[model samples]
Target chain A: MGVLMSAIGFGIVTASILAVSSVGFTLQFSVTNVFNLSFGSVMTGTGFIAYALNTSGVSIWASMAIGALCGGVISVALNWLIFGRFIRHGISRFGMVIVTIATGLICDNTIQAFVGPTFYAYNAQPGKAFNLAGMLLTGQELIIIVIAAVMMTATHVGLKSTRLGAAMRGLSVNASLARACGVPTRRVVAVAWFASGVMAGIGSVALFLDTSTFAATTGSQFLIMVIAAAVLGGVGSAEGAVVGALVVGLATEITAAYWNPELKDVVAFVVLILVLLVRPQGMFSQLSSERTAVG
Target chain B: MSAATQLYLATVSVYICVNVIASWALDIQFGVTGVLNFSFVVFQAAGAYTAAILSLGPSSSSGGFQRYVGGWRLPFPVPIIGAMVVGAVLAGVVGLVSLRRLRSDYQAMVMLVVSVIATIVAESQTGLVNGVAGISLVANPMVSLIHATRQTQIWIFVLFCVFCMALVGVVMYATVYSPFGRVLRAVRENDRAIEALGRNANRHRMQAFVIGGALAGLSGALLVEFIGAWAPNGWFYPETFVFFTAVIVGGRGSLTGVAVGAALVGVGVQQAVEYLPITLNPSVIASLEWIITGILTLVFLWTRPQGLLPERRRRFPTPWRSDAPELAERSAATKGDERG
Candidate 1:
């Protein structure tokens, strides 16, 4: 019982990080319809940037801010440059996927070229664990949970209340229609890219806080789970991503705690496969009319 | 040429031949059938392990250094056949689920996940092919039959690889010219129309997938036999992207193009990087190679989507011929039906 409760606690922490990344992923997909495989590399790059700053004696909070700013800039550049060119060339969605994969490879290998294959640790002392109701968590983990909750709430309120958020949602639904309705579709898309990139950057910092050690390929390694969460939740739905992340996180942690640790990663994949098989449209997808064809 | 140089050339030749076979295997699926099989290396790894275990003889009671099933101590031909069979079976199983239901993008993601999961399993399960250490010390087939220096033996192996490549090429050529190939292309272009014509599109895809998987297995078996080892590290997910880039650069649906692309990208660029006189770290060079491959893929995708040699249009009998008009009419009617 104690083990189970602790696993749940760890699961919530992981779920929080996954929610941040997955929400960013879904937001990008919702607005741009690009799938954005390079988001993984962006996350890793920002994490490394944060690590470098922290090691250089900068405060962690400041490093995170700068990392997120860089992430946003780079992500916007990718959208305005590479993806925009592909879209202009009339590349199909599938073609865009291939392009993003290429972009991801380039980004990952570029980082590896500079950093080599070595891992780096964040410059932070381990905090003491706090136990409450038989569940154990560290100070950092508690802070992460609180930040995730606040972010989720803020995003919910922003989307429901703000004009820019309304414009973003409208663009996601129908870009041309949104433009016709006097919404600034292009600006909204740019904002979406920057916002998602910021989310990815912050999420990477949280991930580094949780894991402490990371390598150039760390973000790509976590990519499958982020993709699984976003797709399982409903590709365009942020709230659904949180729900999907919770399920994946709890399942992975519980399996790792009780069963073999190595099998934990496999649990998310199995769930993804099951979800794809049973409900191809995902949990909260609104676009049921679009059927996928092979060509 | 120096003896050492000759030996190196022979080894490189063997690899080139193996890559050609693998490229053709991928061409059949991704090129001809339009199924983006991102987990292609998994099929190859499956074949490699099957061949290794089958030919490695029985394990000890304690299961030797690496634990695996079916230590049959099979002969050369038997292990190769076993590899092909295993590849086909695995493809059939994977295809039944993914090809039948999922969209193309989803299928790609699922296969990627499967590849990652397979690697994790292979790395962690000590009972399966010795975990990360992988299976080594694989005896080369028919080594006893040859009485010559090591260099000469390598040349002989190269000859054998050339023979295998020719055989695979001939088979692939036959498939391309056959009516079945036309139907496969039709399915790729429009599966719904193919379904309307009273044929199962999914079944055709599965057949192509199984055949491609068998060829991939054959390539893996040949590669492992030559290298005398198999490891999880050798068959990473990125390896599949390399093959895809080759197909794209060569020409997806063209067999000859696949050969050319494999030669250029798989053998040429990779080997060229090794011989470059750059004074950089080896890791930097490796990363540069990957970056080059990524750039090549993107360039091809953006500018030359059809590849270096676009697929040649298949010629049919002229309308003056007795049966040509009727066949043409039927095709036109099918197209009209689809558009309507």
Candidate 2:
């Protein structure tokens, strides 16, 4: 019973991080209609930026903000420079996927060349553990949970209430239709890239905080799980991402606790395969006609 | 040629042959069938591991270094044949699940996820092909049959690889020219149309996938035999991208083009990048190779998507046929309309 509760606590913490990253991933996919495989490399790049900042004596909070800002900038640059050009040149969406994968290779290797391959430790020390209802948690984990909740709430409110969010949502549903309806799609897309990049950046920091040690391939390693969560939650839905993350997180942690720890990552792949096989449109997706086909 | 130069040429020849075979395998899948099989390296790895274990003999429980199934001490051709069977079986299973239910993009993502999962499983479960440490010191098949020096043995191996390459090329060429090849092209152009024509498109894809997997396995077997080692790191996910890039750069749906592309990208560019006198660390140089390949793929897709030698028009009738004009005209029109 104690082990189960503690696992659930850890699961919640993981779910929080996954929610942030998965939502960000789904957001990009929603607006750009590109899978954005390089999103993982962006996460790694921002994580390294935060690491550099922390090593250079910046406050952790400040470093996170700066890292997120860098992420947003880079994300927008990628969209504008690479993906945008490909789209303009009439590259198929599948071709865009290949292009994004290439971009990921470039970004990941560039980081590897600069940083080398050794693992770097995040500088923050863990605070005292707090127990609530037989579930023990650390101060950092608690903070992460709170931040995730706040971010999710903020995203929800923004999407529901703000004009930009509405435009973003409208664009995600149908870019041409949204443009026909007088939505500023180009600007909305840029905003979507920025917003998603910010989430990825902050999520990377939270991931680093949770894991403490990371390398160039760390973000890429986590990418599959993020993709799984995003796809499971329904590719374009923010709330669906959170729900998907919770399910993935709980399933992974519980499986790790009960089964072999080495199989933890395998659980996510299983879930992804199952979801793809059962419902490729995702569980919460309302759009039935958006069926993907080979070009 | 000097011994060192001879050895270098031999090594490069072997690699070129292996990559050509693998590229052809990928060409059948991606270029001909339009299945973006991102988990390609997994099938190749499976073949390598299967061949290694079969030739290495049974794992000794006492040898605390590594563990794997089957130490059958199979002879020269048996292990290689075993690899092909294993590769085909694995591909059939994977294709069955992925092709039946998912769309192309989702299928590609699932394959990518599968590739990663396979890697993780290999790394974590040390018992399976000895995990990340991998199986090493695999003896060259039939090395004892020839009473020759090591250099001569390597030359003989090079000849063997050349023969294998020629055999694969001939078989692939035949397959491409056969009626089945036309069906594959039709499926690639429009599976829905093929289905509407009362043919199972998915079945055709699975057949191509399995055939491709078998060829990939054969390539892996040949490669492992040459290197005398197999490891998880050797078959990374990005490795699949390298093959895909080769097919694209070579020209899709053309066997001769695949050969040229594999030679240029797999051997020429790779060797050149590897031998560059950059002051960076070797690992960085390796990373640079991937970066260059990625950039190369993007540039090709952007500038000349048809590649340098675009696939030739599929000939419809043999020259012996006197009534070829109408069929030829129809084929020419269809060829112009074909987009894959």
Candidate 3:
């Protein structure tokens, strides 16, 4: 019972990080409809930015805020410079996917060239562990959970209440219809990218803090799990991302606590593949793809 | 030529052969069939491991250094054949699960996920293929069979690889140019239209997947046998993009083009990078290679989607109605579906 409770605690922390990143991922995907394989690079970039700040004696939280803003700017710049150009060039859907892949490879390798294969860690501390009901969590993990809750609430309210949110949703469902409805297509899309980047920054920092050490490829490595959570909940849905992250986070931690630690990730992947094969539409996704649209 | 130069040439030739086979395998799936097989390197790794385990002595026998399943003391041809079979079977299993009526993008993500799963399992399970350090010191088949000097044995292995390449080439020619090839191309063009004509497009894709898997396995088996090592580091998911770049550069659906592409991209890029005037870090050089590949893909996609040597447009002499003389050239830019 004690083990399970601690596992749940770790799961919550993991879920917190995943929820931030996946929501960022899914939201941009919702607006642009491009599966940004390079989103992980944004996380890595922001993590390093925070690293640079922390190493130079800046406070970690302040660095996080600045790093997040940089992440937003970087993501928006990537769209404006590369993705937008390719889309305007009128590449096929298959071509678009390939183009994004090329973009990601370029980004990842560029980072690799500069950083080499070395691993890095933040200058901040994990602080003291607080035991709450059997689940022991450090100060950092607790802060992360609260931040995730706040971010989720903000996104939920923003999407539900704000005119900008309505325009974004409108664009996701039908771009042409939304344009006809006078939604500023270009502005909303860019805002989505920015928002996604900010979330990526926060998520990557939380993840790095929890994991302790990091590297250039860390974001891409964790990307598969982020993708799994998003896919499990259904692509392009923020609420589903949270649910999916919790499910994945708990399943992985519980599996580790009970079974071989090495196989914990394997269990989460098995669930992903099964869910993908059995239900590609996912649990919470409303827009059925043409392949799954029919009876 | 010096003996060292002679040995170097032979090794390069063997590498060329291995890459050509692998690229053709990828071409059949991605180029001709339009299946986004992002987990391609996994098939090659599977074959390499299969060959290594079959040929190597039992893990507990020689100093008990490495641990893995199925360390049979098999002879020359058996391990290579075993590798191909295992590759096909793995492909079949993966295809059955992923090749359903899902969206193409979704299918691609599944392939990526599968690739990640394979890597995690390989890295985590220490007993399986000796974890990260990998299986090494795999005896070249020629060294054991023929009693000769090391150079002579290596030359013999090179000959065998060339022979295998020729056989695979013949098989590729037969499959791609035949009526079956036409159907496969049709499936890539529009699967819906083929279904309307009473052909199961999904089954056709599965067939391509299995065939590609076997050939990819053969390539890996040959590579491992020559290089004498198999490890998780060599088969990461991003490695698939290298093959995709080869197909795109060489001209998809063209056998000759793809072989030329495989040689140029796989061999030529590394050689070119080596000759750069300024000294640099090894890791930086690796990054440069990828960046160049990424750039090359973008440039080719933008300018010459048909490639330098485009797929030959077959001419059907329609004397009854001389409307069009040859099949239309489908540029990679706008060849297949406009949108998924």
Candidate 4:
């Protein structure tokens, strides 16, 4: 019982990180219709940016904010410079995927060359542990969960109320129709990329804090799991991403506690595959229709 | 030539042959069939491991330095054949899981996930393939069989690799230019149209996948037997892209083009980059290789999607009526291709 509760506690923290990143991933994908494989590189870049700031004596949270802003800018720049150019050049959907993957490989290797092959850690401590019932979690973990909750609520409310959010939603549903209805497709897509980058920044920092140490390849490696979570819920739904994160988080943690810890990821992947087998369109997606990439 | 030069040439020849075979396998699946098989390296790794275990003695041999399942002391050709069989069987299993009626991108994602899962499983199961340390010190079969010096054995292995590549090339040519290959290409262009014409598109994909897997296995088997090592690090998911780049640059669906592509991109770029006077660290050089590969792919896609050597477009006879007397010379000019 104690082990299970602790696993759940750990699961919540993981889910918090995953929710941020996967939501960012799914949201941009929904609007742009390009499976941006380089999203993880953005996370790695932000994480390293935060690391530099934190090591330079800035507060970690402040560094996270700055890193997230930088991530947003970088994301926008990538879309503008690379992805947008390829899309405008009349690349096929399959070709677009290869383009993103190539972009990811280039970015990842460039970062790898710059950073060299070494592990890095932030100066911030995880802080003291707090216990509730049989579950125990660090102060940092608790803070992450709180931040995730706030972010989730804000995103939900924003999507429901804000004009920008409405434009994003509109663009995702039907790009041409949304353009006809006067939604600024380019601006909304850029905003989506920015928002996604911000979430990625937050997620990468929290992930690094949880893992305690990381390398250049860490973010890209973790991306497979993030993809699993996003695909499990459905590719384009923000809410479904959150739900998928929770399920994946819980499955991995519980598997670690009960079974082989190293195979915990395998367990989460199995859950994803099972879900996909039963529901090919994912939990929240309707029958997916082929749509040309908009932004 | 000096012994050193001879050894260098032999090693280079072996790698070129292996890469060419692997690229041809990828061309069949991705280039010809349009299946984004992101887990292609897993099949190659499977073949390598199968060859390793089959050629090497039991797990208890050599003071138990490595532990793996099915370490039989098989002779010469048996291990390579075993590798191909295992590769095909593994591909069939993977195809069964991923060849569903899902979206193309979704299918690609599933294959990627499957690849990550395979790596995790291999790393975790220490007893299965001796864990991350990997199986090493695999004996080359020629050392025991041949009554010659080390150099002779190396040359013999290189010759064997060339022979294998030639055999694979002939088989690929027969398969690609055949009527069945036409169906595979049709499936790639439009699966619905093939289905309308009374062919199961998915089944055709599976067949191509299985055949490709077997060829990949053969390449891997030859490679491991020559190199004498098999590890998870060498077969990571990104390794698949090397072959993809070869196909893209060589022209997909063109066997000869892919072979030339495999030689130029797979062997040429890596070797040429190393000769640059910059003299960076080994790791950075490795990173540079990947960056160059990525940039090369992008440039090729932009400048020439048809590649350096494009797939030959087959033309059929457009029968004209005898009434159109003036069009006789024009019809002769638009000659049909020698596809067969």
Local distance difference test, each candidate: 0.85, 0.86, 0.87, 0.89
TM-score of each: 0.94, 0.94, 0.95, 0.96
Worst 10-residue stretch by lDDT in candidate 4 chain A?
A286-295
TM-score of chain B of each: 0.91, 0.93, 0.94, 0.94
DockQ comparison, 1 vs 3, better candidate: 3
What's the TM-score of chain A alone for every prediction? 0.96, 0.96, 0.96, 0.98
Query: For candidate 3, what is the lDDT?
Result: 0.87
Best by lDDT: 4
Between prediction 2 and prediction 3, the one with superior TM-score is 3
Candidate 1, residues B213-310, lDDT tens digits: the string is 99999889988888888989888788888888889899888999999898888888888888888778988888888898899989988888878886
Q: Which ten residues in a row have the lowest lDDT in candidate 3 chain B?
A: B324-333
List model 4 lDDT by residue over B1-340, tens digit each.
9999998899889999999999999999999999999999999999999999998889998798888987899989999999999999999998988887777888888899988999999999999988898888777888998999999999988888999999999999999999999999999988999999999999999999999999999999999988899888988888888888899898888998899999988999899988998889999999999999999889988877767798987755436665454464566456432111
| Candidate 1 runs further than 4 Å off | A288-295, B61-63, B315-340
Q: How well is candidate 1 docked (DockQ)?
A: 0.53
Candidate 3, residues B122-209, lDDT tens digits: the string is: 9888899899989998889999999999889999999999999999999999999999999999998889999999999999999999
User: Compared with the true structure, what per-residue lDDT tens digits does model 1 show for residues A138-164?
Assistant: 988888888789878888888889998
What is model 2's DockQ versus the real complex?
Answer: 0.59
Residue range B1-340, candidate 2, lDDT tens digits: 8899988898899999999999999999989988889999999999999899888877884375668866778778999999999999999999987898576777888899889989989998888888888998787774865878888888898899899999999998888778898889888888889999999989999999999999999999988988888888988788898898899898899888888999988888878887787677888987888888888889998887777788887555768878787779877887674333
- Where is model 2 more than 4 Å wrong at Cα? A288-295, B61-64, B315-340
